[model samples]
Target: MTNENNPIDFGAFTEPKKRPEPVSAPEESKKEKGRGERQEWVSRQPAAEPVAPQKATEGQISIKGPDHIIERFKQLCKDDRRVYYDMLEILMDKFEGK
Candidate 1:
């Protein structure tokens, strides 16, 4: 840009170099347009079976106890192929006679 205010030309405050336009691939090479648009052809592979959603637990808790007891609890959970929280939930239900 031509400088009008200052007699000195520092090449600052000038418009940046323009970037070249990106080249787009052929339409046939592009994937299905978008999620919203419906396709004319059916997919060859079978769709995956939908799984049931698990229950959401919003409550958060923190408990401090003896280290030995905690280690024993973790061992028991590993033996039964259960998570610490899942076993805790089961224990809670058993106590409530659910």
Candidate 2:
């Protein structure tokens, strides 16, 4: 079996695959050393004080719609809460002539 009409010879494609070189022990040690140095630097830094949660600056808007519509909307946003909020922002922007 052969592809006679093809300009390129397919027989040249069967070259032996080259195996990847193994990582030397020193390289592995250096990686570990680098990680340890990073951890040490991070640990040396001053700990941040716990921040209290800030209340929403803009008052919340409650939309009263049919239960099925609200349920469908919630289902659409099942993957992410940001999707729903971002969509609301987009709609509001369109209405406000932004």
In the range 15-82, model 1's lDDT, one tens digit per residue, is 88899999987655454565645445778865987787998867878879999998999998999999
Candidate 2, 2-96: lDDT as tens digits: 56687787776887899999966655565686755432434765588778899877656799999999888777677455567776776689999
* Model 1: colliding residue pairs: none
List lDDT for all candidates, in order. Answer: 0.81, 0.72
Superposed model 1: Cα runs more than 4 Å off: 1-59
Judge candidate 1 at residue 39 and give its lDDT.
43
Listing every candidate in turn, what is its Cα RMSD in Å to the true structure after a full C-alpha superposition? Answer: 10.0, 15.1
Clashes of each: 0, 0
